[model samples]
Target: MVADGTKRSRIGMGFLVGAALVAQPTAARAFNPFGLFGEDKPAVTANAVAYDLQVQGLDGKSDVLTAVRDVSILYRLRQEPPQTGDELVRRAEADIPRIVDALWGSGHYAARVSIVVGGQVIALDRPASGPVRATVDSLRGRALVPVAVMIEPGPLYRFDRVAVLDQRSDLPFDPAELPPRVVTIAPGDPARTADVLQAAAALSDHFRDRSHPFVKVGRRSPVIDHTARTVDLTLLVDPGARAGIGGIGVSGTKQVDPAVVRSFIYAERGDPYSRRAMADIRRSVARIEAIGGVRVREGTALDANGQLPVEVEVTERPLRVIGGSVRYSTIDGPALKAYWAHRNLFGGAERLRIDGDLFYFTGPQNWPGGSNRRGFNTDDIGGRLSASFLKPALWGTRNDLLVDAFVQRELTELYTSNVVNGTAAIRHRFTDSFNVRAGIEGEIGRSTDVLGRFDYGLLGLPLAASYDTTDKPLDPTRGVRVTASVTPYLGFGDAPDAFVISRIQASTYYALDDAARTILAGRVAFGSILGGSIGAIPASRRFYAGGGGSVRGFEYKSLGPRTLGGIVTGGMSLFEASVEARVKLTDTIGIVPFFDMGQAYAGSVPDGSAPLRYAAGLGLRYYTAVGPIRFDVAVPLARRQGERPYAFYVSIGQAF
Candidate 1:
């Protein structure tokens, strides 16, 4: 009867959580709002109990037979609730049934043999704070957030009687702490579910501290706890102190060594059980070239002696993918780009990507820059290669490496420049919240008919760091990334004019509200050149800030340092800034109304040669099975000191 009861309870609980209320909720996981905020504030209000208590998955239809009621019982462990005020007493009376009903819906209590009542219950809020801290209010000199909260019942009296459940009769650390007061089940006293859970957790953590993280402590609730306020405890145990590899499996594989695949599994023979280590294995698997949605579920088998036989099952996802896009806008005209990438191209090791982007006019439009081809047109074809590795970061940190190369061209120019560039980078993810990346970049080539020179290509090094506490990556509700990098040539090497470039970039995204889920995104980047007949930064690197990456109101490459005649004036550089608000309509698609502002002093792309470009417009994004395809029609909100504000953009990917 007991076993059957537990099974039915689990089934009912699953049915409720899976089939009740809200259909198609937000994505699988939501970034924690309170945690993302600067700091977590107590949920409990000063006089009242709740500051932000979300009654998640609350169902109103199950109250009939389930008779779910939220209840809070008082226990005498620390202190008991007063038999006092009408408000506290009245409120508790009303709230108790509600809480009790809610918990009854909980799987544990759902199938109790007694339909109505059997055990007394107690309800209390467990507030967690600075933990084992050397001092209070200490945020500095910390490697991680040392504070946490947990809810528990029953002061699980420590025990001397504990045995390995697996070994059947194996013994370790005497069973002297066996039975004491409250040794058997008691009525009215809520079962010590929390105590069992906490004990298991504490035991697991104890093993993790030494980095041998592979010890699995298996326990199920009540987990059969017999205890009273004052009683010694006995724990039945399951011991597999050592974990061993059973074998391995593959997902999304072309041709990679099974041994190499096995390496990603941080858990190994004799390793201690560790959730953290398992998580690392998952991340590494996802990062393995050409794979998506990589998920690793781990389990263990027990021998007659209670020893654990480790088993790891793998599920591989797709890596090589091809996709095409079409978008229409006023500024970019009708644009399309085709891309192909192999996450795990040849094997599960390296990354290879190829893209061809073409920009054209919807109609033959006259430009301020006189006879510039029939209409706006440009084409870019590029490929990048990256090899992953871990490197030591400054201050004893470690980071990953990505080395890449690319080549591209200008289709409409009277003078076309074909260029080649290569870059090597090391990025150190210092912690979950912070990281730094540094790299060296170099390029060599011929400009229009500019003579091809390879005198030690100019070196570009970008050093950057970022902090993110947000829950999601691509669709962050709140987060910030800041960067600074410089690439100076020894004067584009003895060119007519010697020019060097330096730039700084900053971007931030914040959610306006959770219920409404509104978002605000902003960006700013400054680029300038120094020295010689060297010439303005190449239209490529000189920095064009107004379009997609900058002020969405502007056109691509259209918004940056430019001169009259819609030509990038021969000298000088520019800085751009923009802010926009985004509203997500669905998981994949959204719309944004934005105001754009920026300018160009030296070089230029079509759209303008003015010192300031102003634009305001609304953009629409359709989230597809593959990714988001975007379209925007922006008109100048106000005429700039020297330019026109009418332009449209259609493209894939976020504006920034």
Candidate 2:
């Protein structure tokens, strides 16, 4: 019986230690480096009590108050009150050093903290007196214990002097020689612990960027002058031997060939070691669909070749993936899309995907010359089937080959067509943010429009370039994205013509605050068909704007030029611009108010003959792990005759 009881005590202690380690914040952890359990004490069972925790002397110091509250075990676990007054006393005792550290971290180096439990002052310098013990003992059967925390936040410490020195020589660098941004800590600036530590890290990075792979910020010695309320900080840096790239290795590759993984890394042997190179290597390896995660490890010391050795560790994701999405709009009806992909084919990180989509399930069935009333009809349904193949690192580490083919039938207000198209392209990534592609595409289709029925076969060469610096793909808060593309085509069969289509679009985002809770985003786009007349070009090849992705207030493809007989003919030129203010009301929810303007013209360019349509709307976003689920309600600011008063849309991700 004794042995069993001992074992149970040990187990309970182990659980408590684990929980404390996980629950405590960084400041608390630093104060108690060892596990929280000093010795195993038997669990005490007493009636839980309601308690009032009052923190004083921080009336105006909200920052310090918040920090203190965050690290207070009594405040954090208030819902589950301590079973005994002794346990409460222990918790208050444990919080003393943590609270002091929190105060010091916020530049209050001379701060003092005290605690009074149940009207008994717990002196920091001495153990509890007889009367204090008696007061605590009297709370054995009480239902309440009022605790007060008193803090004396002296003066805020400012930087007196800051210096960076060589670890071995103990020689300080001249202040004038160091870069302006390297030593962020300056005299007269608040000597907050975070700023001091950040300055040390910045100094270390400065040397590391200059080819010091093993640079270390060895020690930070701070001397506090209490009388002057200032701190003098000195950072010791050990910039190890300058090194170059040594042996590059890859590990954790299961199905992917190790050699193929190495090909994705752009860093070469004997190249000067750089932090940027390691980041680039990590990104390149992660770009592979099969690679779930990547870790670039650097050797602690230089290798036999006097260069830094790098090891690329990667975790493989599932080989096969299947997913789908659905979207709907008042004007375009509902659409369902599904796809299945093989991330790694033949162990080379090659990807192959097949997709199927059904759209316009219940939408307006307006033939070339018919009424626009919405209705459901089996014959009006449109669907598409497509397949795509990607071969990464085809010619070199920076290039990839892409091949795609699709067959689809469309039923729209302006035209009806069944088309098959195929494209082969080689995309070369110049950098993480920039890429360019040139491809050859061919399309064969037959369509019936307001003009008449026509069969056409077209061949085109398309060249495109994209630059994106957005922080996130689904929803971005900052940076810009620009894309330009031009495709020259030769039409054959029934509709013989030559045309060149050129388009350029740019979007930018600016975060209004550091947290990015509010963002201002804008976009502008322009497109023109230089050669072919509007009537000669295939309806599918022409530009049309409206609906969910374009001007949201209007119907799908309803913003372009119309025929005299009331048939809607697509445009040869297009222009679009939109602005949005995305504001997050909560972590998982956001609201966006947006304005959109654009027009499609019969002429080859936007000649100002046609007026631009305007729309304004408010959108609700439910943020998720993958992206935001979007719901928007929009109305045309300048509603034309016969146009709907408002439109609503539901989809995933941001509108852009």
Measured by lDDT, the strongest candidate is 2
Name the lDDT of candidate 2: 0.78
Per residue, candidate 2 scores C-alpha lDDT tens digits across 408-465 of 9886767778899999999987767789999999999988788788789999999999
Predictions in order: lDDT: 0.44, 0.78
At residue 497, give the lDDT of candidate 2.
Answer: 78
Q: Write out the backbone clash pairs for model 2.
A: none
Query: What number of clashing residue pairs does each candidate have, in the order they appear?
Result: 50, 0
Q: In order, what is each prediction's RMSD in angstroms?
A: 19.5, 9.3
TM-score of each: 0.48, 0.79
Give the Å error, residue 176, model 1.
Answer: 32
RMSD of 1: 19.5
**Against the hidden true structure, what lDDT does model 1 obtain?**
0.44
How would you encode candidate 1's per-residue C-alpha lDDT over 1-656 as one tens digit per residue? Answer: 12232222222332112111111221222123323311333332223321111121322323221223223321110022222222222332333334433343342232211010101111222111224121211222221211111111112223223333322354443334222221333333333334444555655554444333355665322222222222122344443344433333445444543443554454455454455555655665554453444555454454454334444444444656777777665532556677776654445344566666555543223332123445433432222222233222223224456666666443222123456777778876645456677788777654531222223235566566666554344455677866665544543553423345666667788777754358888877666666542243343344454555566555455554333444542234566777778888887668888777776555322234455766778888786654557787777666555555566666665566
**Poorest 10 consecutive residues by lDDT, candidate 2:** 14-23
